[model samples]
Target chain A: MSRLFRSVSLGLFLCLGLLLISWWNLFAWSVVPVSGADVLHAFTSFNDQTIAHRIVLDLRLPRLLTALLVGACLASAGAIMQGLTRNPLAAPSVLGVNAGAALGMALVSTLPFLYGALSTSIAAMLGGGVAWLLVMLLGSTWRVGANEHGRLVLAGVAISALCAALTKAVVIMEEDQAAGVMTWLAGSLADARWQTWQAFWPVALISLIGALLIAPSLNVLQLGEDNARNLGINLLRSKLLGSLLVLMLVGAAISAVGSIGFVGLIVPHIARLMFGQDFRLCLPVAMIIGALLVTLADTLSRAVTYPMETPAGAILALIGAPFFIYLVRKRTL
Target chain B: MSLSAHQLSVGYHGHTIVKKMDLTLPDGRFIALLGPNGCGKSTLLKCFARILPAMSGEAHWQGQNLHHYPSKQLAKELALLPQTQPIPEGIKVKDLVAYGRSPYTGFWGKLSTQDHQIVEQMMKQTGTYELRDQLVSELSGGQRQRVWLAMVLAQDTPYLLLDEPTTYMDINHQVELMHQLQALNKQGKTIITVLHDINQAARYCDHLVVMKAGELKYQGSPEDVLTSTMLKEVFSLNAQIHRDPVSGTPMCVVED
Candidate 1:
């Protein structure tokens, strides 16, 4: 209980610190750099016609929220995926959910009428659902019982490759839509509008709540299917519900900020390493750590090449890959 | 009856391993299921545990169909210890055993006072109370088996089904485990175990259910079931069956 309190307090502090940093970054480095005082004034005076206030309120705050939501959603999704599949490498991107969402967005851009943010979001969700279904089907079919973890990884890799190729094909054919999607595909928070946050928070909240609700089952599932079954866990229900929750999370994240990679892949592992392997602790800690990591990455993306934004995905991958390699070598997973 | 199966056929996809079989296990008896490899003893046990769907018929505990009972309800009544389960890493023995209270606990999986008491009781009963704080991954095979059995016992079910519960244990630990199970059985819990060792089954089990090629060959007291003729027919081996002076139970010695 003290450990739980300590971890929770630690997560809360980190999140609070990250929140301040995110808020400060929103105003400090933008098209027009605004002072912290002005940023504060902007929050106090919402109706202020000052350009700095408008920039802080209308532009950066929403983007910051979007990044935080994406980070939390993707990270939680990855953690849940890792738990369900019992595979350390499992994540939204690795399992092809993000790529499927990207493909969905690409396909939606092809349609002459369904080009709105909502339509694209729905399309991405459907695509993610399809990909999740495919991965599950493949995972189950190729499952050799003992080597199921390996099979799941293989299926994820195969589906991710397939979806990436198809998304590329779509991008290559549509030159007009390419520019709009290019930054998104690389995973940027630049286009995060208020509407994006409006659409995103609900999905993120629902998935987080869903993750908490099913965390007990996930913990049991880590014991393997037979033990979980004897312990009264409905394996099919947990798997299906978990998959659906992950799909929603990955779909919402991709729809909001394109496909931010590695946050989903590494945040869960980091959380587990810091806090124990129990999903009850890991899930919530992963959320806070995920939010911090992406917000930090976004800050780095803004600052690293001042006046020119670097994609957050690239930044996350730079950090995540080395950590992943370290974890693999250490076999901590 | 504690548990029974009627016209039960269990198998893998598109293949029936255990044909239409009927079994009624008497209440509070320590029973052992003995059969040759691939003779469907495991499959039958799995079917009873509701891990596998019955290919044709139904299984029941008390008066309710096993399938009809909610998973938690069934879990409260029956606990199955499979032959092998992948041990999760970084889990303390106490935490792993606490999972047995999942049927009774709420969504958060917090152990109430009673739940904690039961968990402690089970750990003590299985001789794993001292190892409660140790990581499951760090335990030896016998220690691990006992811990797993502790988890099963923590399930607090009236009926326990174990598939080769003593597989990884040495003779000493195996006998200790058998004695622990005997204590549990004496406390009114019905235990149905599938064993590879005929002698061990005969010594420990009050009743024997022998199978050959997915069919029940004999079901009775060990003295009636462990006869030389039955052994020859079921195991396809000529064996001398003699009572041991110690326990006076039937012992099989294979003839060259």
Candidate 2:
């Protein structure tokens, strides 16, 4: 098959698979009534006032959409981060961006002043920005020679741990707010209301678009720092711009549904395996696979308990950890 | 256009590696920079290519300080192929070569028809056209080196700088790459390369710059500089020099 045809077909397959999973979860949960012809009935019925429609549209649909959005955001952010750092393992969570957003949300939630919905997101954005700045600064100082890849990874790990400690301390101080913060920290999509979706979707869309626009330069960057510079790619400007896009995507996703893990870490590797290493091709494929993986996880979360839903974050961990181990054993990453 | 370094001092993090190095390459000359390991030949070449920051002196290209030109314009003038492996994993050979056009491209740099033609010609010239669809990681050391050279060739610059471009290859591929570079120089592209092989440097280069411990030991034609005295002083080796049977270039035989 031609490259374009193969890519388009793969994309359609992923979209169809997500749709099937969404439908299955809806029927299994009795969110749409479990009839003998549940698939057919669910497709045809559109009574907005019915309990089934209300549950499917108001509750399940928003959560699903949130999962898809956050997953794509995290995966794209991870891909961009990995490309920028030129480290295969670099991701938002590993590089401290997620921890920073969580810290920001935790702080804002405890504020005595009445913080409206927008305040939490703004705080999360600031936290993500600050964390990235800290990583860059520390990494720069620790860079021993021409190769800074190892130093940057170490700096990211150190900063992530520090941010996690601060976040934990804040949680301890405000024990009452701890319950809400805990669920967010666990990275649940259950609380994704329409308002939360409104807050995150635009940032994710804009940043993803921006990332695709710069995808070509990323190929130049993969050639290493000196060669990329020789190609007339302004290394500093490209790094800063790419990091900013990552910050926006990751910060918005984290603020919407706190610290969803594994999607960022695993989706890019999977995309690289499936689509080869071209960033132009890998970015979109990663986004689709990211959406599919999270949606599948969210569907399993809703059905695993039947009536009682598990947090999608827990399901991702349960699925992702073993898959990650398998990848390591296979030496694919 | 010509490239000249005026008392150039280059190094990393405050320690000068190449100091007070003044050199000039007239347009279209094949210049070889020869030195022992850690003798600062690579540092000097990097300074000329603007890969390393000039610590205290100037690199002038076409009568203007190279530092004054924007990086894009500078890249358009010169290309460097540092001795390094191609990025690991599935980077296609054609895509790797196309990176040479990056300096001339805009933000959404689509490969123009001319750019594609140049890349195709470079691949053909470097004998990498057959491997255009192949992954760089799968190529042998010699083939990978040629692909890298093709990438630099696709840049279509007037001057090309290569740092030990013959490091990992066998004698045959090494000679082939040097011959290709000589051909390029003959086509009016000024070529400056750091070479470890003394005989290769003597045979291929129009001019030779010999360095010892970060300072110039000699600079002139290979016939003038690759003498027994200078070779022993710079390389700490006794060598006998003879005219090559074919090219009439200096041929060296080390004394035991």
Candidate 3:
């Protein structure tokens, strides 16, 4: 038991170290480079006249905060979804959540009346809710016994493909909005700002707390539905509340960061590999791992290309796809 | 009465499996539900355990409707062991058994010292104490079955419902488990199980309920219910029934 606590504390400390490094990296290695001393001076004593101060306060801080929050939110949501479906491959992107949220945001952007971050997030939540309901309806039709994981994956892929096609069709019809939509869909953190963090943090906090609260029920759920029901878990209520929380997390994330992928898909897997499968331990660790993963990826994306920004999603998939294939070969999923 | 189903109709998706059947299960008795495949034995057991909702009528616990009882309160009264449980990946036996304390534990599911002692006691009772640290996936089928039984026992309910609990065990282990359940019955726990083997059911269970095609064919002692003609009618097999020499219970030998 002490060993387990030691390992968890070690993992937490490692995450904190990485988060500090990410903060340093965010300040030090942007389009306009600032030295370590410059970063310190800018943070400790602010002057509007200094270029370092301007960059750190206006650009780096918000972008750093956005990446951390969005990453944590999406990854935690992915963990919950995996538990809900009892399928490890279940992620927001695979479940058509990202696509649905993107579609909602896209539509809201085009509409004259709905033009703010809150409206966009609300629309995204509604879209994600619809996708979740459809998946539940479709998933329930099948018996979902031994091959439930594979069948649900197939259903998710089909729904994702349909949503992707519809989103593309909508974007193509509007020529003026196409560039912004295309960039957002590619998932860059270049435009992250204070407003984005302000719009997102409450939802992220709610989601994190909600996931922690439901972690015990999820443990019972992993024993299967009948056993869980017999063990006094209200299956329908747990599942419904869990899915709603996932939607809030994913919706807030997509709206803030514009559909960053694979953090949701891969971070939970890595967390499980490091920690055990107990959700009480895994949920917090998953959030930490998620924050670390995206922060590193976003920092590397900006640094590798210098002035030209690269989408973090592209970098993540370049790494994530191979890992996914390895998992498939191992038959773990 | 431990559990009584009144005008109960159970099914899925508007199709009924067990329809409008009324029955009362007596407390502190070892009961066996025997039926052929697709005869609704499992479905009926699930209904009594409250895992499935009755399509028409009420299932009662101590004269109150089972549905009316709060789920946690009901769980404290009845423990169910379903067949074909999925093992969560990389879970240890001790951790798995700790889940049984969820009803008594608060929202965080933290195991108190008393809860841990109960879990340990259950593990020892089911002979899974040695395997507590091992991962579930690393254990063999029989060992895994015992571990699951320990989990159910850790729930420490007064009434237990098990559907084919002996599926993966060897003959020796099966008899051992039956004796353990008998010990539990002697301690005043009501045990209702669905069993495949007629001889084992007859030897171990005091009361027998036989079903055919979702309807109750017989409900009595094994001697009264396990007749050769009733065996042929219910199981569609030719069998000879005789009293066991050791226990004086009805034992059947199927004639091919």
TM-score of 2: 0.91
| Candidate 2 lDDT for residue B250 | 88
Candidate 3 has an lDDT of 0.84
For candidate 1, lDDT tens digit of each residue in B98-189? 99999999888988999999999989988899999999999998899988999989999999999998888899999998998899999999
Candidate 2, superposed: residue stretches over 4 Å from native:
A22-48, A111-118, A133-155, A327-333, B236-238
* Candidate with more favorable, higher DockQ: 1 or 2: 1
Q: Residue A280 error for model 2, in Å?
A: 1.1
How is the predicted docking of candidate 3 categorized under the CAPRI scheme?
high
lDDT of candidate 3 at residue B9, scale 0 to 100: 85
Residue-level lDDT of model 2, residues A124-236, one tens digit each, is 87888899789878878224234565676678889989989999998898889998998888887778888888878988899989989889888788887778877877777
| lDDT tens digits, residue span A65-139, model 1 | 888888889999999988888888888887778888888998888655556645777888888888877987887
Question: Among all windows of ten consecutive residues in candidate 1 chain A, which has the lowest summed lDDT?
Answer: A141-150
Residue pairs that clash (backbone atoms under 3 angstroms), model 1:
none
- TM-scores of the candidates are 0.96, 0.91, 0.96
Better of 1 and 2 by lDDT: 1
Q: What is the lDDT of residue A25 in candidate 1?
A: 67
Model 1 accuracy (lDDT, Cα): 0.86
